[model samples]
Target: MGNQTEVTEFIILGLSNDPQLQIFLFLVFLLVYLITLLSNLVIMVVIRADPHLHTPMYFFLSHLSFVDICYASTVEPKMLVHFLAEHKTISVNSCIAQMFFILQLATTEIFILSAMAYDRYTAICDPLRYMERMSKEICVQLVSGAWAIGFFHALLNTVFALKLHFCGPSQINHFSCELPPLLQLSCTESLTNQVVLLTSAVIFASSSFLLTLISYIHIISTVLRIHSAEGRRKVFSTCSSHLIVVGLFYLTGFLQYTKPSSVSSVVLDEMFSIQYSILTPMLNPIIYSLKNKEVKTAVGKMFQKFKFLK
Candidate 1:
């Protein structure tokens, strides 16, 4: 293929066209973005302040919250701007950067969730050795490893994406800069890019998902061995939030990215991406806070402290 480089920027045809709907979506997403930031910040602050939450589980949860905040920040702010901006255009470099960060943070989140599942498994299945197993040092390494892996994974994808040459029809039919939408705008042959995307998605997503699934299998097996219903309930409560989060994250991600490229619909891809990237971050902190008693107590204590300070 000969060089056909011409387009320098992309026009993002965002979620809606009507003025009323644009304003409405802008407000709705603005509110959601703020709440996501506040909730995740609260989770992190409360976890750090409360001594009782200094365990490996809360440590992982705090990191998870941080990742959620980053994930939402990467996509939502740009989307909000697009909702109102007349140009709705982003430079190629800027678009690639957005996609890179989104992929990095999202990949980190999945790895972190897998770590959280392991933590739960250690807590419930081998309570006596939980501390011995998941020490502070180990927790730091795990979280760091997740971030590092995500970084490199994203780097690989971004490197491949960089090879794609965008020449014309630079209008992306999506709210944010994502791989699928961006690829559609590329004039260059995207065989290598698509192969890399599919390969990395399978490796990263499948491995983390399998780890989480295996951990949950052991967790369920351990929970069943307990004779008392209360004991089972307690154990289940500890993991139910994580399970729900995992399910939502994986389901939407799989539906969005794992489809055959020939059959992908831009509209459907955008909607599914919204579920995982936009809604999942907001839902995670709420789910954990609601389902976990310790988190609720920590939140209550933090609120009381704020009131006293006021």
Candidate 2:
């Protein structure tokens, strides 16, 4: 304790240090952030406005859009600011809060995706009992459970992080204050923190991923059993958007976190992070709109309403 020096703030070494690049990156990320917010907000609004879309599938999707908005909002706003700021420093407390929210929202989103997979599974595998199996009460419980688990998972990580002492270098080599980069800065032995992070991440991520995988396996089996090609295509289309989303989220995230340290580099880290964290949110609404006939119809009707008012 006597030799420990207090670190009140951390200097964030953003993606680039070049003046010209900073300005360019600022504009690029700002545009991406705005698109993320707008697209997600549109998805939520469209889902809410259409009563026909109030099924279990769209209910999960509306929540997913809301989570995407929140997940991007957690990191992009600060990152955009950092792109223009010369110092690009964040207080210790702010960094912790940012990490907490990022973890919570991200965890919640994967579970929500898992829930969607289950919804699709029920709809396709047992159409007659779909309404009974996935009632409004059950859907609400699934969403609420996701949120509750995410909150507690983040809280546990944050509590452990608070115990770590950062007496050494305060420079974070990534765009945002992620747990991995932050853990590297602690002067104290971080073995326990590392263990907890790895253990919990594996437990939470694997369980949700397994559930999604099982749901899809059952779905594919059922789809294959259908005799008509048109029938198979119609069934696949209903959940294809969600399948793409899950692949994007899990694959990028898995690569980012599970890559060998020997192959890790700052550029690779930033690229993977951007893929899952920034670009995915912007792409989600586009995927759903393109793949989903119902969403497209709703958006078309919405545009017609606006034109009529004008």
Each prediction's Cα lDDT score? 0.91, 0.91
Put down candidate 1 lDDT per residue, 1-310, tens digits, no spaces: 4667678899999988898999999999999999999999999999999999999999999999999999999999989998898889999999999999988998999999999999998988888999889998999999999999899988998998988888888899988898988888888799888888888889999999999999999999988899999999988988899999999999889767778977787778887988999999999999999998899998999899899999
Candidate 1: worst 10 consecutive residues by lDDT?
1-10
Model 1: residue 13 alpha-carbon error in angstroms: 0.4
Q: Per-candidate TM vs. native?
A: 0.97, 0.98
Off by over 4 Å in 1: 1-5
Q: RMSD in angstroms, all models?
A: 1.2, 1.1
lDDT of 2 by residue, 205-224 (tens): 89999999999999999999
Give the clash count for each candidate.
0, 0
